[model samples]
Target: MTELTIVANIHAKPDQTGLVKTELLKLIPVTRKEPGCLRYDLHLDNDDPAHFMFYETWESRGLWQDHINAPHLADYKAATEGAIAEFTLSEMSLIG
Candidate 1:
Protein backbone atom coordinates (compact mmCIF):
# COMPACT_ATOMS: atom_id res chain seq x y z
CA MET A 1 0.00 0.00 0.00
CA THR A 2 1.07 3.57 -0.64
CA GLU A 3 -0.75 5.14 2.30
CA LEU A 4 0.95 6.52 5.36
CA THR A 5 -1.12 5.61 8.38
CA ILE A 6 -1.60 7.44 11.65
CA VAL A 7 -3.73 6.31 14.53
CA ALA A 8 -4.47 8.63 17.42
CA ASN A 9 -6.00 7.37 20.61
CA ILE A 10 -7.58 10.09 22.69
CA HIS A 11 -9.28 10.27 26.01
CA ALA A 12 -11.48 13.19 26.88
CA LYS A 13 -11.70 14.80 30.28
CA PRO A 14 -14.78 14.00 32.34
CA ASP A 15 -17.85 14.63 30.18
CA GLN A 16 -16.00 16.38 27.40
CA THR A 17 -15.92 13.47 24.98
CA GLY A 18 -18.88 14.78 23.05
CA LEU A 19 -17.26 18.16 22.65
CA VAL A 20 -14.00 16.58 21.57
CA LYS A 21 -15.74 14.52 18.92
CA THR A 22 -17.51 17.57 17.62
CA GLU A 23 -14.28 19.52 17.45
CA LEU A 24 -12.44 16.69 15.77
CA LEU A 25 -15.05 16.51 13.03
CA LYS A 26 -13.89 19.95 11.98
CA LEU A 27 -10.57 18.46 10.93
CA ILE A 28 -12.15 16.45 8.14
CA PRO A 29 -12.32 19.22 5.62
CA VAL A 30 -8.95 20.66 6.45
CA THR A 31 -7.26 17.30 6.03
CA ARG A 32 -8.98 16.76 2.70
CA LYS A 33 -7.41 19.93 1.42
CA GLU A 34 -3.90 18.70 1.99
CA PRO A 35 -2.38 17.53 -1.25
CA GLY A 36 -1.08 14.23 0.07
CA CYS A 37 -3.78 13.31 2.52
CA LEU A 38 -5.76 10.25 1.55
CA ARG A 39 -8.35 9.66 4.24
CA TYR A 40 -9.05 10.81 7.76
CA ASP A 41 -11.66 9.22 9.99
CA LEU A 42 -12.68 9.75 13.60
CA HIS A 43 -14.21 6.94 15.63
CA LEU A 44 -15.60 6.53 19.13
CA ASP A 45 -14.93 3.42 21.11
CA ASN A 46 -17.97 1.19 21.46
CA ASP A 47 -17.09 0.26 25.01
CA ASP A 48 -15.89 3.64 26.14
CA PRO A 49 -17.64 6.80 25.07
CA ALA A 50 -14.89 8.97 26.50
CA HIS A 51 -12.34 7.28 24.30
CA PHE A 52 -11.87 8.41 20.74
CA MET A 53 -9.57 7.54 17.89
CA PHE A 54 -8.58 8.85 14.49
CA TYR A 55 -7.38 6.88 11.49
CA GLU A 56 -5.52 8.92 8.93
CA THR A 57 -3.86 8.02 5.68
CA TRP A 58 -1.34 10.36 4.12
CA GLU A 59 0.93 10.23 1.12
CA SER A 60 4.10 10.30 3.17
CA ARG A 61 5.76 11.26 6.41
CA GLY A 62 6.62 14.60 4.85
CA LEU A 63 2.96 15.40 4.28
CA TRP A 64 2.15 14.25 7.78
CA GLN A 65 4.85 16.55 9.12
CA ASP A 66 3.33 19.40 7.18
CA HIS A 67 0.02 18.63 8.84
CA ILE A 68 1.55 19.09 12.29
CA ASN A 69 2.96 22.48 11.29
CA ALA A 70 -0.30 23.75 9.83
CA PRO A 71 -1.71 26.68 11.77
CA HIS A 72 -5.01 24.99 12.49
CA LEU A 73 -3.21 22.02 14.00
CA ALA A 74 -1.90 24.16 16.85
CA ASP A 75 -5.41 25.16 17.74
CA TYR A 76 -6.50 21.57 17.43
CA LYS A 77 -3.74 20.44 19.73
CA ALA A 78 -4.40 23.27 22.15
CA ALA A 79 -8.13 22.73 22.26
CA THR A 80 -7.68 19.15 23.34
CA GLU A 81 -4.76 19.49 25.73
CA GLY A 82 -6.43 19.80 29.12
CA ALA A 83 -9.74 18.69 27.78
CA ILE A 84 -8.09 15.49 26.67
CA ALA A 85 -6.94 13.31 29.52
CA GLU A 86 -4.60 11.22 27.41
CA PHE A 87 -3.38 11.09 23.82
CA THR A 88 -1.27 8.57 21.97
CA LEU A 89 -0.17 8.64 18.37
CA SER A 90 1.13 5.75 16.26
CA GLU A 91 2.63 6.13 12.83
CA MET A 92 2.59 3.22 10.41
CA SER A 93 4.45 2.51 7.25
CA LEU A 94 3.05 -0.14 4.94
CA ILE A 95 4.85 -3.33 3.97
CA GLY A 96 4.17 -5.55 1.00
Candidate 2:
Protein backbone atom coordinates (compact mmCIF):
# COMPACT_ATOMS: atom_id res chain seq x y z
CA MET A 1 0.00 0.00 0.00
CA THR A 2 1.16 3.54 -0.67
CA GLU A 3 2.07 5.71 2.28
CA LEU A 4 -0.33 8.41 3.39
CA THR A 5 0.73 12.02 3.77
CA ILE A 6 -1.38 14.39 5.84
CA VAL A 7 -1.22 18.17 5.91
CA ALA A 8 -3.31 19.67 8.68
CA ASN A 9 -3.67 23.38 9.21
CA ILE A 10 -5.05 24.72 12.48
CA HIS A 11 -5.92 28.31 13.14
CA ALA A 12 -6.50 29.22 16.74
CA LYS A 13 -8.51 32.12 18.01
CA PRO A 14 -6.38 35.16 18.69
CA ASP A 15 -6.65 34.78 22.43
CA GLN A 16 -6.27 31.02 22.42
CA THR A 17 -3.11 30.44 20.47
CA GLY A 18 -1.10 29.52 23.52
CA LEU A 19 -3.60 26.93 24.66
CA VAL A 20 -3.81 25.35 21.25
CA LYS A 21 -0.04 25.26 20.88
CA THR A 22 0.46 23.57 24.23
CA GLU A 23 -2.13 20.91 23.48
CA LEU A 24 -0.66 20.30 20.04
CA LEU A 25 2.78 19.88 21.57
CA LYS A 26 1.42 17.28 23.97
CA LEU A 27 0.42 15.03 21.08
CA ILE A 28 3.88 14.76 19.59
CA PRO A 29 5.53 12.38 22.01
CA VAL A 30 2.65 9.92 22.08
CA THR A 31 1.89 10.06 18.39
CA ARG A 32 5.50 9.56 17.43
CA LYS A 33 5.47 6.25 19.27
CA GLU A 34 2.31 4.97 17.63
CA PRO A 35 2.55 2.10 15.17
CA GLY A 36 2.93 3.03 11.49
CA CYS A 37 3.84 6.65 12.17
CA LEU A 38 6.70 7.54 9.88
CA ARG A 39 6.94 11.27 10.57
CA TYR A 40 4.87 13.84 12.46
CA ASP A 41 6.02 17.43 12.46
CA LEU A 42 4.50 20.67 13.65
CA HIS A 43 5.15 24.18 12.37
CA LEU A 44 4.02 27.65 13.28
CA ASP A 45 3.50 30.43 10.75
CA ASN A 46 6.16 33.10 10.96
CA ASP A 47 3.77 35.94 10.29
CA ASP A 48 0.81 34.56 12.17
CA PRO A 49 1.30 33.16 15.61
CA ALA A 50 -2.16 31.63 15.64
CA HIS A 51 -1.57 29.56 12.54
CA PHE A 52 -0.17 26.07 13.00
CA MET A 53 0.37 23.13 10.72
CA PHE A 54 1.21 19.49 11.01
CA TYR A 55 2.89 17.44 8.34
CA GLU A 56 2.53 13.71 8.87
CA THR A 57 3.36 10.55 7.04
CA TRP A 58 2.04 7.12 7.93
CA GLU A 59 2.66 3.69 6.56
CA SER A 60 -0.91 3.40 5.31
CA ARG A 61 -4.29 5.08 5.40
CA GLY A 62 -5.67 2.41 7.76
CA LEU A 63 -3.00 3.17 10.31
CA TRP A 64 -3.58 6.88 9.89
CA GLN A 65 -7.30 6.31 10.53
CA ASP A 66 -6.42 4.48 13.72
CA HIS A 67 -4.35 7.45 14.80
CA ILE A 68 -7.24 9.75 14.08
CA ASN A 69 -9.45 7.87 16.53
CA ALA A 70 -6.90 7.65 19.29
CA PRO A 71 -7.87 8.64 22.80
CA HIS A 72 -5.30 11.40 22.94
CA LEU A 73 -6.68 12.92 19.74
CA ALA A 74 -10.12 12.99 21.33
CA ASP A 75 -8.68 14.71 24.35
CA TYR A 76 -7.08 17.31 22.12
CA LYS A 77 -10.37 18.01 20.40
CA ALA A 78 -12.14 18.36 23.71
CA ALA A 79 -9.49 20.66 25.08
CA THR A 80 -9.37 22.90 22.05
CA GLU A 81 -13.03 23.02 21.13
CA GLY A 82 -13.78 26.72 21.13
CA ALA A 83 -10.16 27.71 20.82
CA ILE A 84 -9.82 26.69 17.19
CA ALA A 85 -11.11 29.18 14.68
CA GLU A 86 -10.49 27.03 11.63
CA PHE A 87 -9.12 23.62 10.79
CA THR A 88 -8.27 22.04 7.44
CA LEU A 89 -6.81 18.70 6.58
CA SER A 90 -5.54 17.26 3.33
CA GLU A 91 -4.53 13.73 2.47
CA MET A 92 -2.00 13.46 -0.31
CA SER A 93 0.22 11.01 -2.13
CA LEU A 94 3.99 11.40 -2.45
CA ILE A 95 4.94 11.15 -6.08
CA GLY A 96 8.63 11.55 -6.72
Candidate 3:
Protein backbone atom coordinates (compact mmCIF):
# COMPACT_ATOMS: atom_id res chain seq x y z
CA MET A 1 0.00 0.00 0.00
CA THR A 2 1.06 3.56 -0.59
CA GLU A 3 2.10 5.76 2.32
CA LEU A 4 -0.32 8.36 3.59
CA THR A 5 0.60 12.01 3.75
CA ILE A 6 -1.30 14.44 5.89
CA VAL A 7 -1.06 18.19 5.66
CA ALA A 8 -2.88 19.96 8.40
CA ASN A 9 -3.20 23.71 8.60
CA ILE A 10 -4.30 25.23 11.85
CA HIS A 11 -5.16 28.87 12.36
CA ALA A 12 -5.41 30.11 15.88
CA LYS A 13 -7.54 32.93 17.13
CA PRO A 14 -5.54 36.15 17.10
CA ASP A 15 -5.31 36.23 20.85
CA GLN A 16 -4.60 32.55 21.33
CA THR A 17 -1.54 31.90 19.21
CA GLY A 18 0.71 31.03 22.11
CA LEU A 19 -1.74 28.61 23.64
CA VAL A 20 -2.48 26.95 20.34
CA LYS A 21 1.20 26.62 19.55
CA THR A 22 1.88 25.05 22.90
CA GLU A 23 -0.88 22.57 22.41
CA LEU A 24 0.28 21.72 18.91
CA LEU A 25 3.79 21.11 20.18
CA LYS A 26 2.45 18.70 22.73
CA LEU A 27 1.27 16.38 19.99
CA ILE A 28 4.66 15.83 18.40
CA PRO A 29 6.36 13.75 21.04
CA VAL A 30 3.45 11.43 21.54
CA THR A 31 2.44 11.21 17.92
CA ARG A 32 5.94 10.36 16.79
CA LYS A 33 5.88 7.35 19.04
CA GLU A 34 2.65 5.99 17.70
CA PRO A 35 2.60 2.97 15.41
CA GLY A 36 2.94 3.67 11.67
CA CYS A 37 4.09 7.23 12.15
CA LEU A 38 6.89 7.85 9.70
CA ARG A 39 7.28 11.60 10.00
CA TYR A 40 5.40 14.20 11.94
CA ASP A 41 6.66 17.73 11.64
CA LEU A 42 5.18 21.04 12.65
CA HIS A 43 5.81 24.48 11.18
CA LEU A 44 4.83 28.02 11.98
CA ASP A 45 4.31 30.59 9.26
CA ASN A 46 7.14 33.13 9.21
CA ASP A 47 4.87 36.13 8.73
CA ASP A 48 1.82 34.73 10.43
CA PRO A 49 2.45 33.58 13.96
CA ALA A 50 -1.09 32.36 14.35
CA HIS A 51 -0.81 29.93 11.47
CA PHE A 52 0.62 26.46 12.00
CA MET A 53 1.00 23.43 9.78
CA PHE A 54 1.70 19.76 10.32
CA TYR A 55 3.31 17.59 7.68
CA GLU A 56 2.93 13.94 8.49
CA THR A 57 3.64 10.65 6.80
CA TRP A 58 2.00 7.48 8.01
CA GLU A 59 2.44 3.85 7.05
CA SER A 60 -1.20 3.48 6.16
CA ARG A 61 -4.53 5.22 6.23
CA GLY A 62 -5.92 2.86 8.85
CA LEU A 63 -3.09 3.54 11.25
CA TRP A 64 -3.47 7.23 10.68
CA GLN A 65 -7.15 6.93 11.43
CA ASP A 66 -6.24 5.26 14.70
CA HIS A 67 -3.99 8.18 15.49
CA ILE A 68 -6.75 10.71 15.03
CA ASN A 69 -8.92 8.91 17.53
CA ALA A 70 -6.24 8.75 20.17
CA PRO A 71 -6.94 10.01 23.66
CA HIS A 72 -4.29 12.69 23.41
CA LEU A 73 -5.91 14.01 20.27
CA ALA A 74 -9.25 14.18 21.99
CA ASP A 75 -7.66 16.04 24.85
CA TYR A 76 -6.07 18.46 22.46
CA LYS A 77 -9.42 19.21 20.88
CA ALA A 78 -11.04 19.80 24.24
CA ALA A 79 -8.18 21.95 25.44
CA THR A 80 -8.22 24.14 22.37
CA GLU A 81 -11.97 24.26 21.89
CA GLY A 82 -12.36 27.94 21.18
CA ALA A 83 -8.74 28.82 20.59
CA ILE A 84 -8.57 27.64 17.00
CA ALA A 85 -10.03 29.89 14.33
CA GLU A 86 -9.81 27.38 11.49
CA PHE A 87 -8.44 23.94 10.78
CA THR A 88 -7.89 22.20 7.46
CA LEU A 89 -6.50 18.78 6.72
CA SER A 90 -5.58 17.14 3.45
CA GLU A 91 -4.72 13.54 2.72
CA MET A 92 -2.51 12.95 -0.24
CA SER A 93 -0.23 10.59 -2.10
CA LEU A 94 3.40 11.25 -2.89
CA ILE A 95 4.06 10.72 -6.59
CA GLY A 96 7.70 11.50 -6.31
Candidate 4:
Protein backbone atom coordinates (compact mmCIF):
# COMPACT_ATOMS: atom_id res chain seq x y z
CA MET A 1 0.00 0.00 0.00
CA THR A 2 1.21 3.52 -0.75
CA GLU A 3 0.30 6.22 1.76
CA LEU A 4 -0.38 9.72 0.50
CA THR A 5 -0.56 13.05 2.32
CA ILE A 6 -1.54 16.25 0.54
CA VAL A 7 -0.95 19.62 2.15
CA ALA A 8 -2.84 22.15 0.05
CA ASN A 9 -2.36 25.72 1.17
CA ILE A 10 -5.24 27.41 -0.49
CA HIS A 11 -5.25 31.16 -0.65
CA ALA A 12 -8.95 31.75 -0.75
CA LYS A 13 -10.51 34.96 -1.91
CA PRO A 14 -11.09 37.34 0.95
CA ASP A 15 -14.56 37.04 2.51
CA GLN A 16 -15.05 34.07 0.21
CA THR A 17 -12.79 32.05 2.47
CA GLY A 18 -15.75 30.65 4.36
CA LEU A 19 -17.41 29.53 1.18
CA VAL A 20 -14.27 27.86 -0.03
CA LYS A 21 -13.78 26.22 3.33
CA THR A 22 -17.32 24.86 3.25
CA GLU A 23 -16.64 23.45 -0.17
CA LEU A 24 -13.42 21.88 1.06
CA LEU A 25 -15.13 20.32 4.03
CA LYS A 26 -17.59 18.61 1.73
CA LEU A 27 -14.81 16.40 0.40
CA ILE A 28 -14.14 14.58 3.64
CA PRO A 29 -17.06 12.19 3.62
CA VAL A 30 -16.98 11.73 -0.13
CA THR A 31 -13.29 10.80 -0.11
CA ARG A 32 -13.55 8.53 2.88
CA LYS A 33 -16.14 6.41 1.10
CA GLU A 34 -13.94 5.90 -1.94
CA PRO A 35 -12.31 2.58 -2.56
CA GLY A 36 -9.08 2.02 -0.67
CA CYS A 37 -9.39 5.34 1.03
CA LEU A 38 -8.02 5.05 4.51
CA ARG A 39 -8.50 8.58 5.71
CA TYR A 40 -9.49 11.98 4.34
CA ASP A 41 -9.31 15.07 6.52
CA LEU A 42 -9.49 18.81 6.01
CA HIS A 43 -8.01 21.46 8.28
CA LEU A 44 -8.00 25.23 8.29
CA ASP A 45 -5.18 27.32 9.69
CA ASN A 46 -6.19 28.91 12.99
CA ASP A 47 -4.24 32.10 12.28
CA ASP A 48 -4.80 32.12 8.54
CA PRO A 49 -8.16 30.96 7.37
CA ALA A 50 -7.01 31.36 3.80
CA HIS A 51 -4.59 28.52 4.33
CA PHE A 52 -6.14 25.04 4.23
CA MET A 53 -4.69 21.57 4.37
CA PHE A 54 -5.98 18.21 3.23
CA TYR A 55 -4.50 15.13 4.78
CA GLU A 56 -5.50 12.02 2.83
CA THR A 57 -4.38 8.44 2.89
CA TRP A 58 -4.98 5.74 0.30
CA GLU A 59 -4.23 2.09 -0.15
CA SER A 60 -2.37 2.58 -3.41
CA ARG A 61 -1.65 4.94 -6.24
CA GLY A 62 -4.42 3.45 -8.32
CA LEU A 63 -6.97 4.08 -5.59
CA TRP A 64 -5.84 7.65 -5.35
CA GLN A 65 -6.29 7.97 -9.09
CA ASP A 66 -9.83 6.73 -8.69
CA HIS A 67 -10.52 9.50 -6.22
CA ILE A 68 -9.40 12.14 -8.70
CA ASN A 69 -11.90 10.84 -11.20
CA ALA A 70 -14.78 10.83 -8.75
CA PRO A 71 -17.69 13.01 -9.81
CA HIS A 72 -17.92 14.71 -6.43
CA LEU A 73 -14.27 15.59 -6.53
CA ALA A 74 -14.70 16.99 -10.01
CA ASP A 75 -17.62 19.04 -8.80
CA TYR A 76 -15.58 20.25 -5.86
CA LYS A 77 -12.82 21.50 -8.12
CA ALA A 78 -15.32 23.23 -10.31
CA ALA A 79 -17.23 24.70 -7.39
CA THR A 80 -14.09 26.12 -5.81
CA GLU A 81 -12.89 27.57 -9.12
CA GLY A 82 -12.11 31.27 -8.75
CA ALA A 83 -12.09 31.03 -4.96
CA ILE A 84 -8.65 29.50 -4.75
CA ALA A 85 -5.32 31.11 -5.42
CA GLU A 86 -3.03 28.05 -5.40
CA PHE A 87 -2.97 24.43 -4.32
CA THR A 88 0.11 22.30 -3.74
CA LEU A 89 -0.27 18.55 -3.39
CA SER A 90 2.41 16.31 -1.92
CA GLU A 91 2.46 12.51 -1.91
CA MET A 92 4.16 10.71 0.94
CA SER A 93 5.12 7.21 1.99
CA LEU A 94 4.67 6.35 5.64
CA ILE A 95 7.50 4.65 7.51
CA GLY A 96 7.09 3.31 11.05
Candidate 5:
Protein backbone atom coordinates (compact mmCIF):
# COMPACT_ATOMS: atom_id res chain seq x y z
CA MET A 1 0.00 0.00 0.00
CA THR A 2 1.10 3.54 -0.65
CA GLU A 3 1.42 6.13 2.03
CA LEU A 4 -1.48 8.51 2.65
CA THR A 5 -0.78 12.21 2.51
CA ILE A 6 -2.72 15.12 4.02
CA VAL A 7 -2.45 18.81 3.44
CA ALA A 8 -4.30 20.80 6.06
CA ASN A 9 -4.77 24.52 6.09
CA ILE A 10 -5.85 26.55 9.09
CA HIS A 11 -6.79 30.18 9.21
CA ALA A 12 -7.11 31.58 12.68
CA LYS A 13 -9.21 34.43 13.94
CA PRO A 14 -7.17 37.58 13.82
CA ASP A 15 -6.68 37.88 17.54
CA GLN A 16 -6.30 34.18 18.18
CA THR A 17 -3.44 33.42 15.83
CA GLY A 18 -0.85 33.00 18.53
CA LEU A 19 -3.07 30.86 20.72
CA VAL A 20 -4.14 28.68 17.84
CA LYS A 21 -0.55 28.19 16.78
CA THR A 22 0.45 27.20 20.29
CA GLU A 23 -2.12 24.42 20.34
CA LEU A 24 -1.20 23.25 16.85
CA LEU A 25 2.49 23.08 17.67
CA LYS A 26 1.74 20.93 20.68
CA LEU A 27 0.40 18.22 18.39
CA ILE A 28 3.68 17.75 16.50
CA PRO A 29 5.78 15.82 19.00
CA VAL A 30 2.92 13.58 20.06
CA THR A 31 1.80 12.87 16.50
CA ARG A 32 5.32 11.97 15.45
CA LYS A 33 5.34 9.16 17.99
CA GLU A 34 2.17 7.52 16.68
CA PRO A 35 2.47 4.07 15.08
CA GLY A 36 2.01 4.85 11.38
CA CYS A 37 3.10 8.44 11.16
CA LEU A 38 5.81 8.80 8.52
CA ARG A 39 6.03 12.57 8.64
CA TYR A 40 4.16 15.42 10.36
CA ASP A 41 5.28 18.93 9.74
CA LEU A 42 3.69 22.31 10.42
CA HIS A 43 4.24 25.45 8.39
CA LEU A 44 3.16 29.03 8.87
CA ASP A 45 2.47 31.26 5.90
CA ASN A 46 5.19 33.82 5.47
CA ASP A 47 2.92 36.60 4.29
CA ASP A 48 -0.18 35.68 6.20
CA PRO A 49 0.38 35.61 9.90
CA ALA A 50 -2.92 33.94 10.60
CA HIS A 51 -2.45 31.10 8.15
CA PHE A 52 -0.92 27.76 9.00
CA MET A 53 -0.73 24.36 7.36
CA PHE A 54 0.29 20.80 8.10
CA TYR A 55 1.92 18.37 5.70
CA GLU A 56 1.61 14.79 6.83
CA THR A 57 2.32 11.31 5.55
CA TRP A 58 0.97 8.10 7.00
CA GLU A 59 1.78 4.44 6.43
CA SER A 60 -1.83 3.65 5.49
CA ARG A 61 -5.36 4.95 5.43
CA GLY A 62 -6.36 2.87 8.44
CA LEU A 63 -3.52 4.29 10.49
CA TRP A 64 -4.45 7.78 9.41
CA GLN A 65 -8.03 7.19 10.50
CA ASP A 66 -6.74 6.07 13.88
CA HIS A 67 -4.74 9.26 14.08
CA ILE A 68 -7.79 11.43 13.43
CA ASN A 69 -9.57 9.84 16.36
CA ALA A 70 -6.61 10.05 18.66
CA PRO A 71 -7.04 11.82 21.98
CA HIS A 72 -4.48 14.47 21.25
CA LEU A 73 -6.27 15.49 18.07
CA ALA A 74 -9.54 15.80 19.94
CA ASP A 75 -7.87 17.96 22.49
CA TYR A 76 -6.51 20.19 19.80
CA LYS A 77 -9.92 20.61 18.22
CA ALA A 78 -11.54 21.37 21.54
CA ALA A 79 -8.82 23.79 22.51
CA THR A 80 -9.09 25.78 19.31
CA GLU A 81 -12.83 25.44 18.84
CA GLY A 82 -13.95 28.91 17.85
CA ALA A 83 -10.48 30.33 17.50
CA ILE A 84 -10.07 29.16 13.98
CA ALA A 85 -11.83 31.06 11.25
CA GLU A 86 -11.31 28.55 8.49
CA PHE A 87 -9.99 25.01 8.26
CA THR A 88 -9.50 22.81 5.20
CA LEU A 89 -8.08 19.33 4.88
CA SER A 90 -7.11 17.61 1.65
CA GLU A 91 -6.25 13.92 1.40
CA MET A 92 -3.95 12.93 -1.43
CA SER A 93 -2.18 9.92 -2.91
CA LEU A 94 1.37 10.24 -4.18
CA ILE A 95 1.63 9.99 -7.97
CA GLY A 96 5.12 8.53 -8.07
Candidate 6:
Protein backbone atom coordinates (compact mmCIF):
# COMPACT_ATOMS: atom_id res chain seq x y z
CA MET A 1 0.00 0.00 0.00
CA THR A 2 1.05 3.59 -0.59
CA GLU A 3 2.11 5.74 2.28
CA LEU A 4 -0.42 7.93 4.00
CA THR A 5 0.75 11.53 3.94
CA ILE A 6 -0.52 14.39 6.06
CA VAL A 7 0.20 18.06 6.20
CA ALA A 8 -0.82 20.00 9.23
CA ASN A 9 -0.69 23.77 9.28
CA ILE A 10 -0.71 25.46 12.62
CA HIS A 11 -0.97 29.11 13.55
CA ALA A 12 -0.30 30.35 17.01
CA LYS A 13 -1.73 33.35 18.76
CA PRO A 14 0.51 36.39 18.55
CA ASP A 15 1.70 36.10 22.12
CA GLN A 16 1.82 32.32 22.35
CA THR A 17 4.03 31.40 19.41
CA GLY A 18 6.86 30.19 21.57
CA LEU A 19 4.66 28.00 23.70
CA VAL A 20 2.92 26.56 20.69
CA LYS A 21 6.23 25.74 19.07
CA THR A 22 7.47 24.11 22.23
CA GLU A 23 4.48 21.84 22.45
CA LEU A 24 4.60 20.90 18.82
CA LEU A 25 8.30 20.12 18.96
CA LYS A 26 7.80 17.89 21.95
CA LEU A 27 5.68 15.54 19.89
CA ILE A 28 8.42 14.79 17.37
CA PRO A 29 10.44 12.39 19.50
CA VAL A 30 7.51 10.38 20.74
CA THR A 31 5.57 10.32 17.50
CA ARG A 32 8.50 9.05 15.51
CA LYS A 33 8.54 5.93 17.67
CA GLU A 34 4.91 5.07 17.14
CA PRO A 35 3.98 2.01 15.10
CA GLY A 36 3.66 2.56 11.34
CA CYS A 37 5.07 6.05 11.56
CA LEU A 38 7.41 6.44 8.63
CA ARG A 39 8.13 10.14 9.04
CA TYR A 40 7.10 12.88 11.39
CA ASP A 41 8.70 16.21 10.85
CA LEU A 42 8.01 19.66 12.21
CA HIS A 43 8.83 22.86 10.38
CA LEU A 44 8.68 26.53 11.16
CA ASP A 45 8.07 29.21 8.58
CA ASN A 46 11.12 31.43 8.30
CA ASP A 47 9.05 34.51 7.56
CA ASP A 48 6.43 33.85 10.21
CA PRO A 49 7.46 32.25 13.45
CA ALA A 50 3.83 31.90 14.47
CA HIS A 51 3.25 29.62 11.53
CA PHE A 52 4.26 25.94 11.79
CA MET A 53 3.74 22.85 9.72
CA PHE A 54 4.06 19.13 10.17
CA TYR A 55 4.88 16.79 7.32
CA GLU A 56 4.10 13.18 8.13
CA THR A 57 4.03 9.82 6.46
CA TRP A 58 2.40 6.71 7.82
CA GLU A 59 2.15 3.10 6.72
CA SER A 60 -1.63 3.36 6.37
CA ARG A 61 -4.63 5.51 7.07
CA GLY A 62 -5.68 3.28 9.95
CA LEU A 63 -2.27 3.64 11.59
CA TRP A 64 -2.48 7.38 11.16
CA GLN A 65 -5.86 7.31 12.85
CA ASP A 66 -4.27 5.43 15.73
CA HIS A 67 -1.71 8.19 16.05
CA ILE A 68 -4.45 10.74 16.22
CA ASN A 69 -6.15 8.90 19.07
CA ALA A 70 -2.95 8.65 21.10
CA PRO A 71 -2.93 10.02 24.61
CA HIS A 72 0.00 12.31 23.99
CA LEU A 73 -1.75 13.92 21.07
CA ALA A 74 -4.78 14.55 23.21
CA ASP A 75 -2.59 15.95 25.94
CA TYR A 76 -0.89 18.24 23.48
CA LYS A 77 -4.22 19.54 22.32
CA ALA A 78 -5.35 20.16 25.85
CA ALA A 79 -2.12 21.82 26.80
CA THR A 80 -2.08 24.09 23.81
CA GLU A 81 -5.68 25.09 24.12
CA GLY A 82 -6.30 28.76 23.30
CA ALA A 83 -2.69 29.14 22.20
CA ILE A 84 -3.37 27.87 18.73
CA ALA A 85 -5.20 30.39 16.63
CA GLU A 86 -5.81 28.10 13.70
CA PHE A 87 -5.16 24.53 12.59
CA THR A 88 -5.65 23.02 9.15
CA LEU A 89 -4.92 19.41 8.35
CA SER A 90 -4.71 17.91 4.88
CA GLU A 91 -4.57 14.20 4.18
CA MET A 92 -2.69 13.71 0.93
CA SER A 93 -2.06 10.92 -1.52
CA LEU A 94 1.05 10.68 -3.61
CA ILE A 95 0.22 11.67 -7.18
CA GLY A 96 3.30 10.61 -9.00
The top-ranked prediction according to lDDT is 2
Off by over 4 Å in 5: none
Model 6: what TM-score? 0.97
Model 1 ranges off by over 4 Å: none
Error of 5 at 76 (Å): 0.5
- Alpha-carbon runs more than 4 Å astray in model 4: none
TM-score between candidate 4 and the true structure: 0.89
Cα lDDT tens digits, model 5, 1-96, are: 789999999999999999999999999999999999999999999999999999999999999999999999999999999999999999999998
Candidate 5 colliding pairs: none
Give the per-residue lDDT digits (tens) of candidate 4, residues 1-96: 557655456778777788898888898887888888888878788898788888877888888888889999899889988888777888878877
lDDT of 4 at 96: 78
Candidate lDDT (C-alpha), each: 0.86, 0.99, 0.97, 0.81, 0.97, 0.95
Which segments of model 2 are wrong by more than 4 Å? none
Give the higher-lDDT candidate: 1 or 5. 5
Per model, how many backbone clashes are there? Answer: 0, 0, 0, 0, 0, 0
Q: Report the candidate with higher TM-score, 1 versus 5.
A: 5
Q: Which ten residues in a row have the lowest lDDT in candidate 2?
A: 1-10
**Local lDDT at 35 for model 3:** 97
The total of clashing pairs for model 2 equals: 0
What does candidate 6's lDDT look like per residue over 20-42, in tens digits? 98899889999999999999999
**Tens digit per residue, CA lDDT, model 2, 1-96:** 899999999999999999999999999999999999999999999999999999999999999999999999999999999999999999999999
Clash pairs, model 4 backbone: none
Q: Residue 16's C-alpha lDDT in candidate 2?
A: 100
Better of 1 and 2 by lDDT: 2
Error of 3 at 14 (Å): 0.7
Clashes counted in candidate 1 amount to 0
Worst 10 residues of 4 by lDDT: 1-10
| C-alpha lDDT (0 to 100) for residue 63 of candidate 3 | 97
